[model samples]
Target: MVHPLAPLSEASAIPRVRRLSDRHIAVGERWIFSAGFNVRSDLADTGRVDVELADIARLADAGARVAVVSHQGSYRDGTARHLDFVACHLTALLGRAVRYVPGTVSDAAVRAARALRPGEVALFGNVRLHAGEEANDPRFAARLAMLGDRVAVGGFSKAHRRNASNVGVLRLLPGFAAASLLAEAERLRPWSGRDSGRYSVAVLGGTKPEKTEIGLVHLASTYDLVIPGGAVLNALLAARGHRIGASVLGGGGRRCVATAAEVMARTDRCEIHVPRRVVVAPAGAPYSPRRVVDLDDGVPPGHAVVDFLLSPWARDRLRRLAADGGRALVAGPPGMPTPAGTDSWRALGRYFSAPRVRTLLLGGDTVAELPYEGPASTGGGAALYQLAHGTVPVLDELARSAAHMSDMPA
Candidate 1:
């Protein structure tokens, strides 16, 4: 009888894999997976772990020898968080204690690969631990190539970064393909189905304005309506010459705001709408003395706009925008003050859950806020930026690999 996993051998059957590499090892035989699990402005990587869990199961089920490489926490952090922490997160989800090996290219690492028990995974040290991973060093890529016969680039959130693990190793692989999770994320659409032919709305809400610029422009250009929230909202309000008072403005939002203005001016179809009311506190006192006020009433100079888009009028507006929807890409939610902000999340849940809604692309922070769970990504700004632009180099190559394999004959 033919081997149950023999179909994976078809990569050689596909001409591209042969052209890319002379190696004969199947995809499941030995593989290096460069995953992206970094967070956006909110410092949440939970979604990243959740997404990768699916890939782990698939690779394990295929009886593949997998070496999972990922970056954790932020670059700005004094030190990279321990890889064991991520192991903990994955362990909870997989319901099994995963095997972890310390070195990326040590002899011991090779031994661990040799010892794989068919469905077990061996997660390598954080890719960031290796000094050359992010530099796209050819030497580092070569070292990683020593482990895997083929490469799979599935970190859609991390695809934008030209790190060695993402593209460099991909270049070395005789052939490569997309991880099932990353392939799913790459399909993110700005507007879905017949709704694209009609009016569509987008929500760009995240803590950092600088990071959200690309998404803002793309949303403004694609959707009929663009709604700003959190720091993005403050910047947009200021762009229109509204009295911002002392609201928290994300550093470097003006560049994005100016870009949005230019796009709005030229694209008469896209509209920018502001909330009639906002929740505010004394400028320096963001936590206390909070109250709601109509924008028409005017805010005091010492007051800050902590949250908005949860008032009755705001909800009604959201209801209409969300009604008969086309597609919604919510990066995150509007700023909320505890008990006050909680209602906004629930309201957002109701709005996005509308039957007319065609698509919803949610990022990490936005995913956490939703009452109803959906596929979310950890690539944060990088993920949004990738979606706005066309195919990423890493994922693009992976697609080519899959296509090539599909074209091969038995």
Candidate 2:
């Protein structure tokens, strides 16, 4: 795979994004605003919905007809595929009625969008219900494009996707990115840059071992120290010739361990700390009472690693690192979101919360698992993708569309 980090000269070549703030919204103009509302399965917790809400209010309050477009993952095998829940939340948050359109890219949706007067807002149904939405079919893009005079994308979680609603629609209509989305990109960009003098540490872990490995390898180049936890901790242990027993090695299993070994070999610029004491349970039983075990003693057969507990000596090291006044970045949860696993996340959170260690948190699980909120990214996977790969699909589309608009005759 090509290295995700580009030379500074090459990075400078990427076009400047056209933001919604740069556009002049004429009253009554139709705006198809794509937003991300699928944070949790039940949609009970609105992660970063307020950001999109603020942008929508800007357009609606300016007398523009706003039509919201969004997609939700299939719940329990194709159940609960409507946007009414989001509409309800938006209505309450916006302090106004948010009309719910029954379908997307259908005649009824078009009619509802057309019927909306200036300053009114309506949310269309989940676009994923239609096959073309994910396929990025031009026909679907054209239909969605017709729903509005311009497109405003606010779905940072979906920025990595090349769907009709984001990438395809940009090709068919004038496109502008939401301020919140741009802000997310700017915040995550620093991790991929050249290392500075200030000490920086990255705590890398998550349910996805493969992604964690990728992040770990990249971060080691720029950070002063790198710590592995969660499934990543398991893989690194196996790489170091330790018996992890039946611990979760992720879906990749042996392959993940191999990659972890390779990453450890290549990353010589920074120090990597792999916790010796970990919380463990019976292989197939996560609900069982967990016990802390030292890796020096082999993990008993039929058991798996679940979480980590920093030894007192290691804790003192972190405290000293904090006192030096540096920065820290946490990408994923150090443990599973189980009663036993929460301990590790809490411990790491407390350490990073120190005033001297300015912390930057990324990934949804980190936010959901941690007790306190700091600066965080709502889209975990997307944020990781941008961090590793430099740019996302939505940002590229926004820049491309803006460039095309500039070249066109007035």
Candidate 3:
């Protein structure tokens, strides 16, 4: 039951979860879509939520009653956030009324879903507000299952989590992989460990050094080379006793540096290319005449490493890989925007977007900065977690459920 596009090394181990399009989508059938609508404090970036639109629209167009359920904010912070704005945003994008169901798994929410007609869509309230969702309570799962006849998992970002909406609901109903989730699995083909025996490169960056360090270990196994940049590079430099000055460490502190050192010590599977020359500027201020100095030249007392310029040696390696038709993956921004308004994100963006290099970009900032018509994912954490570990928890549950219901049509 492996996906047609999934790698054998990984996919063969999991039971098949049928795609939503393959199911008999009958009119008036209730379709519960589990999606990730979590937003930042600023609420400006809705890409994670927006990516679910196509599949949601697909279900509605097929005359199915649709209910989108997701958490809205960081549940760890204990701050309750509503999905009122998400419903309104969807109404605008869909050009149709999307009823906002103000409770999750509550009697009122169940009533709202039960009242929906064919082709109608509703956005359920934040699932995290319910104590049972995060706990994956069976009773809560039964309550949510009452809203729909089938389940569609469209949130790849939450696939790794074991939550009521993610793993619990599948036990009670037919489950299928939504379009976006399938797209994510397909785009991650590079990390499938298929053993092409060819050159592949992974460029690691992003603000979270701890997460990036974990991905670096996994990326090294799948890719022939692992290149570090951004805060990840800063941590690596610090691990090797190089002075990084005032550059951001993503708040991981000494633990981050220790993790990087550990990775450097144990990583023997792939080549790690650390930038020797870097662009530097005064910390917290834009200064004229930016300096490109060697790594040996420690960052000055009041300065920080702004970006790393690829040496001819590293550039040539990438060029050779491209010539050999190998793939390249960029996880996060290689550099941050300078105080003076210049950005290095575009520099790496241009290189990867070239037609010759088969590229895939992960992370929201990566996709936002470089909008290319190729493999990309906005869920950096989930994307990396899957790449590192071959299976996602929710997807695995859905696969098992699909296998159990094999006697019935999808």
| C-alpha-based local distance difference test score of model 1 | 0.61
| Candidate 2 lDDT tens digits, 1-410 | 11112122245233466778767667888899988776554665687677798889999999999999988873324643777878888899999899999678898889888899999999998888788887899999998987887888987878877889999999978778887787777767655544575667788777665455567667667677778887778888999988888988776677778877887888365777887788888988877888888899967899988788876766776787678767778877777667544677677777788887778877666777766667778777677667666778888788777767542211
Model 2 lDDT at residue 168: 94
TM-score: model 1 vs. ground truth: 0.74
TM-score to native of every candidate shown:
0.74, 0.86, 0.82
- lDDT of each residue in 1-410, candidate 1, tens digit only: 11111122221121121221222333447766677656433435465656567656666667777777777554444455547666666667777667777786677876776677666676777677766777778988888777766665566666666777877776666344444333444445433222455556567666765344676766666666666777777777766667878887665657756755565567443666577777788877666868888787766788988777554555665677566454555676656445445444555667777776654555556666555555455555655665566445665555454444332211
User: Candidate 3's residue-wise lDDT over 47-75, tens digit each?
Assistant: 78778898898889889999889976546
Clashing pairs in 1: 157-379
Candidate 1's error at 173, in angstroms?
1.7
Please give the ranking of all candidate structures by TM-score, highest first, separated by commas: 2, 3, 1
Whose TM-score is higher: candidate 1's or candidate 3's?
3
Where does candidate 2 have its weakest 10-residue lDDT segment? Answer: 1-10
